[model samples]
Target: MDVIIARHCVAAGEDGLSPLQRDLIEHPARIRIAEAPTGAGKSYAFQRALRDRGHRILFIVPTRRLAQNLANGLSNDLQDAGWSRQKAAQSVAIWSSDQTAVLRSQGVASINGVRLLQMTDLGSFDGGMIVATPEVVSGLLIRRRVEAGQAGEGVFDMLEQFDHIVFDEFHSIEARGFGLAALFARLATVQLDNRVGFGVSRISFLSATPLDLKPTLVDIGIPEEAIALLRERIVPDGRPLHGDVRLSLVDSPSLYDLVLDHLNEVVEELAAGRQVVIVYNRLVDLEKDLPALSRKLPEAGIDPARVLVINSVRDSTAKGRHQGGFAIGRQRDPLAYDLILATASVEMGVTFRNADFMLMEPGFEAMSFLQRYGRAARRGANGRVIVRIEEQRKPWLRAVVDWVRERPGERSTIAALTQVLSRSVQAEFSPHNTASTFGQLSSQAKWCTALYWSVLLEHASNRQPRRGHLLAHQPKGAGAFYRLEQRVRQLADEPGLTEQVNHWLKLFHAQAFDLRTIEPKIRVVSDTGEAYDYPRVWLQRETEVFERGIETGDEIHIQGGLDDYWREDKDRHAKRDWICHFPHTTRTLRLPCDERLVNRWCDELEDIDPYEFDWEDHPQALEAVQKLVRLTGLVPGHDPEISLDAVSGVL
Candidate 1:
């Protein structure tokens, strides 16, 4: 079943990945789960899992941006130790949406760059290790071929074509729409028979905090032996490491400015030739700020191309290694980029390992806080992280601070993360403590928690979701409708469908339902009209209270911004961040009305008759609120200008 992929990797001749990673790879199990603390050498563990398990390999990551780093790491580090060229071609392959149709149609090479050619244009390749985002791999798993030879059936047939699969960030598996991860979970149980009968699926699930996975793994049917191998149960978190790291509060009145100042210093250092990683909580800030950040670095003597910025927004936009753009001018050493600014992309792979200092943007969740900080000290070097929380955000950041202060071990970040997940981390576990990710104490001896861990181990070791599945997103709660209308009115100009818009108002008089779902409400009180009636705070977009951040459903933390002028300022700056009720297509949005943007938005929407668009087949425009959010990143709140009832019919 295992096919020798191709000769591509160039060994760095380094000692190897960290100890934890080494243990992960050497494990003989065809499938396993491995948990490491925040900094417990999981990335290195991923490599060994890929190497010893034959040549064919696949790595899945939670973020598209992280896939590149995974690709880079696998290329340099995946050596046979003492094997022939033909013996070493099967560790990894990278398949991203960005790969041009032609390149994907023709076989593409692994990072080592040996285009072995495919059996067909698409399926089955020998020995190649693949790096893929969740969706792309989902498309591949259902197919009969890949970078190497043709595939048959059964889990072994699937496993035969590939030596192993690993996923990074195992805790992220979820369901929002038909994500690759969700599909894999569904199939792993039903099709693969809990990954047992078919010896083909050797896997490992890895995570810093594997708490949330207990329920997911339990849902699937797996046994105890498999479960024990899933999570190694390494060190316990919260043991208290005697480190010199300290947390500082930034009481800067101008919080944004303060963040910029700190960011610039890091950038200056990067320009001065020190590699660094910068993590922020929200993608919106990174989106609007990165271009400016990149612009500022060159003046400080940093090469713009050297710096890489990774975020959810960027992941949605990354075009893969097609057309071979950089195939020629490959640099001998890393370039001089002052720093790599990222959202959650810093959470994986070898990319951030070269640096030991970190600066985190404020107002992020506690678990994420730990993950970002973990990016800094790794590979046996002592590192420190500096945090700058806002004056008002102190209360919320306390959980994260306490977790860090607990100190599981001086170097055992994985343990610290475990304690946080077990105690400090603010997460909603459906089946509380009775069920752990390692093994379940449920009535059914099937061991669902271990199964979940098995999935994570496979994912962690593969650095890829099983069969290239993506981490799923949970379904979010929608808000009231009337408020959604008001938000739409404020953000967008009077749309072209005023007639239908008026017709929607008539429904108010004949009110059929007393609120079908939690969609926000919107009433059309004219500019000169009197105050309207709607629910008090019906789905207000989560605010940055202290200007720290503002994501949809993030909880609006207004600092008396609504006392008096708040009424007039309702629509003002609201479009800059927004909340959408739909799942992934329209999950979360940032609002702040921009007349310039609206004008541009209108121009884009004017020609797009939502009536003529097919959301399933095409992603044209999201002018009408009902249009599936496939076109835009996420759906915005209701548009009072355009009625929801009317949008339902037209879209």
Candidate 2:
């Protein structure tokens, strides 16, 4: 059945390039958004179109696994384009922080002169197909320009070389990355302003769902016309390439219980020679559930050996091997495993052609729902998708589940969810606010901070000079240095930004100076003149308040430098260091009651027996009782301490 369905899917009629692909090949927009279905051959079409245009491609994705998949997919395309295996492998370059670190640790200069490209090594990213994470590419686009640095110039040079920069799986990017893509495009505008060249850098956002296109592009300074260029090319609906697939939404208190409730059915399906995949979004949950599920499967008459756990957090080399092995195992032997437990790391790009069932613990985010469910029924295989969610817990999630339940097609489901999300976001949006970004700090400053930290961490690890001036080494060639000099001159005209950057340089140099030493500590004081010390965290916004000394009215203090002082008495001239004396803890008095007015009051007493108490003359208790009597204005029926239940029984 699987082989027959696979053949039918391969032989399905819509085999040529999509309309969007033909449009891109004929008249590519400066910035284009392509919306297409998963199995519509978008990747192949985009690669071929860009190649025909004589443009080097730089494919950026959200995760490492997707990068690996694209690298392999593009390599096959290169081979099909009449390139040798060795040459094809050399043409595709992967730039990631992890891969670069591995290469550096082995004492190798570069993988064909492509250093990690994280730091100032943008030259290696000169030509050919470069696949990188959003972090790396975004960092390069907005790198700081300095008088003695050529990194900024290197960035422009690399930008000029690539005609098309595609962000695949655009919907999966977080706010930071999505914003960075916008910033990257905006910076390209500045790059174009100074270029004497004849080439223009184009951007393509390829996704199955480009939900918030207008708002995203507008936030990044892209004009409305550029956004109107979004071309949607999808497979026509109601085509029968595979058998009828079933998708059910299961609501349960928890994913664990959902699995147990269907344990017999799962066992029966596995026993019938069907492959099952249990998808988890959390690693901790997967680790806990995998063993429990494995242990319980035996009682249901399923072999434990047929169950396997695939984790993404293992060592990178081991992780790649395991992912590759899983893909191969699935393709070569469809029923090799009865149950496969995986995380959302495999939700995109990777194919599981033979899996007959998918049980997903849907993530909290609505955007990822489509990608997770799309894993099932690949290559037209008949399959079932059961999304187990705690419906009562998350209202927004329940709304999305209901939406998906109503729409069977992937595109329609995404569209409805997108509209729902847009309304939710728009209702909360304030038009009075001029700034698009909804925070105190500017977006530029945030990008600067991200770049600053990446450089700071890298410099500290490489043991490079911490001094900002000394950090800028000489460029390799004259052309890059010349461009760097010109860029520096242009930046020197803004005095306000120049002054702020000078302050930032001093701060960076000081931090670099402390890189080799134990970080300094700050002393804090409580209201009772108690002193406590803790190591200073560079970016800590809130002071740590800890309980010290005995439990007898514990004192809390604001921990900081000697400048933080407080005056206990306004009349006194001397001020006490608040870090040592002014504790932030609140103080309250405790009074113990010696007698209970009724038997029902005995349960509220602690560490003392209410029956044997005799404190008629207690001053604090007398005051409390007097206050209660005045407030209520109720006279005692018989004796003030007598139980009302006993009186009622007598009546």
Candidate 3:
């Protein structure tokens, strides 16, 4: 059965602009948001709006690959629209810390013909477009704020240089602390309040799976009328943008088994010289399946050189061993490979030409599903997507499976599927909780921002010599910039203000900065003294359970000389290594929620009363607790007030 995933029909309004584009160009609000499905020309709309303004622009994306792609694309668009090649190349620049060393050595680097600029260059840059990730922006803001006096640049001074700042893939802001979304909220608040600032730049957020940011904005004191939201509406005469995509859902207990079952088809596609993309949810599953496929491919007369693998490891040295195929360290053209096996690394922003996709069910998020599906049948090419739905006991997964089973042969738009899943799966489990989660996350972000502002205020007052230790404290936050400014003044005269701030910084960093709770990765040393790091969670399973008894810094050996450890890193080191080696077969041990691990992880902050910390206000921190509980069972001897149930209720 074939299902047509339609794109929204966008008609041109005044000046040959779609309604969404027109609003983006003419809307009076200082802050604007555009919500449209993939391939609805959202990028083109923003490009036209920004081009007309001719303002110094800072375009922020979620990934380095995306920043590179957009920088090159923007340059081409400019040249095609009557600008000279030199002018177009000069107008667009990519700002990435990874390219810093290269830029310093060569003065400049080029990505697909667009210039890559050094971070310091931004201080002197007068105009044109600069593309960067959110982390770079946050780092710059923090560095400038901390070193204002000596650096001769304040946070406001840095921001005022840009006439417009656009955050692409704005949905990523829902991440815990100091994430892009929270930073946007804080900046929006500051701009709208007309605080002591100069050359205020308009901010825009673009996302296909847009969040309802209104509630979060209102909570931070922005008025409803001040924010403008432009959504792409379905038109009766609209046509599909990327032709039609045929979606087939297969019920399977294991995605690995499902892939093995379809090995013949995969080989047939490769033999016919058609591109194939298989997406796994974890590296462990990919590692297991690669060797099996590699062994069978030669028997089927397929060359091992046809398989390319990509994962989280971005080091060139780590990926150099895959001479038979290739790994994506520096960007390689996707068309060069006949078969590509990837994790979530390529799930967003990366485009592939005319490929058939096989994807493991990527949890309950509609955004993940939509993004992965968008990779295939791009432009006007028709495509097919085969999704392996593992049997799960969760209510949402059951509902999704039943829904797909019932909809056989019924054609539906991508937008319709998204809406249904958002309501059925996401809403059922945590509809209202999503906004609440972000609000709580934003508050923690606000506190971090407030701390940074307080430091700047202290230095500006000229009351005392600046403490170097205080400067070392990096503040991060999401909302309430005005309130944060107010707090800065209120704390100025207080004795021991620096000490109190430092104390809170330690606590916040412990709770918010720990990445293990979010992604639970482990490091392992191979039999040949090679080390590789990968996520501990099993990809074939549906839950968040992790393998137990594999403590960090444990040395183990692989049976057959690390034949295909694609993530092998010789020079790359970690403070601790987690597992002895990959188990011979899959293990079902749940990550024990032992109090010992929590204490060991956050030993320094154990003295502080968890009860006094207001866990209810910081949903991001609460989420960490929930994750800990989910991974390890309920912690033994844990403080009852801070138990999983308590934290879950707050969330």
Cα lDDT for residue 458, model 1? 29
Return the TM-score for candidate 2, rounded to 2 decimals.
0.56
| CA deviation > 4 Å runs, candidate 2 | 1-15, 24-27, 50-55, 77-83, 110-128, 138-153, 174-180, 187-198, 231-244, 260-275, 296-312, 315-317, 320-339, 401-651
Name the Cα RMSD for model 1: 16.3
- Tens digits of per-residue lDDT for model 3, 38-144: 66666666567546666577788877667766777777788788888877776677767555545566764332122212322432433477888765565454322
What alpha-carbon RMSD in Å does predicted model 3 have with respect to the real structure? Answer: 10.3
Q: What's model 3's overall lDDT? A: 0.52
> Backbone collision count in every prediction?
103, 8, 7
TM-score of each: 0.53, 0.56, 0.68
lDDT of 2 by residue, 485-591 (tens): 23423332444335533332232222211111223334444454434333323112222232221212222354342223322222232111111000011111122
Give residue 165's lDDT in candidate 3 (0 to 100): 74
Model 3, residue pairs in steric clash = 445-477, 445-478, 553-577, 591-632, 592-632, 593-632, 593-633
Better of 2 and 3 by TM-score: 3
Q: What is the C-alpha lDDT profile of model 1 across 1-651, one tens digit per residue?
A: 011111111112255444345556655554355655554556655555545444455667665446665665555665435544443444444566445333645764341122223211212332456666655554333321233332222222344455456667766543321223333333333323254333344566677645344344434433334433444333222221112233333444342355466666665555444567666766545544554555565565565556665554233333321111111111212223345666665565434435656666643555565566555544444444556666455433665445445553333334433354345333343335532332222221122222222223222223333333322311111112223334433322334434443443222211211111123433312223222222223213322222332322323323222221222233333433222232112122333333243343333443444454333432222333332122112222343433455534321
Task: Single out the weakest 10-residue window by summed lDDT for candidate 2.
Answer: 576-585
Q: Evaluated with lDDT, which candidate comes out highest?
A: 3
User: Whole-model Cα lDDT per candidate?
Assistant: 0.41, 0.46, 0.52
- TM-score computed on alpha carbons, candidate 1: 0.53
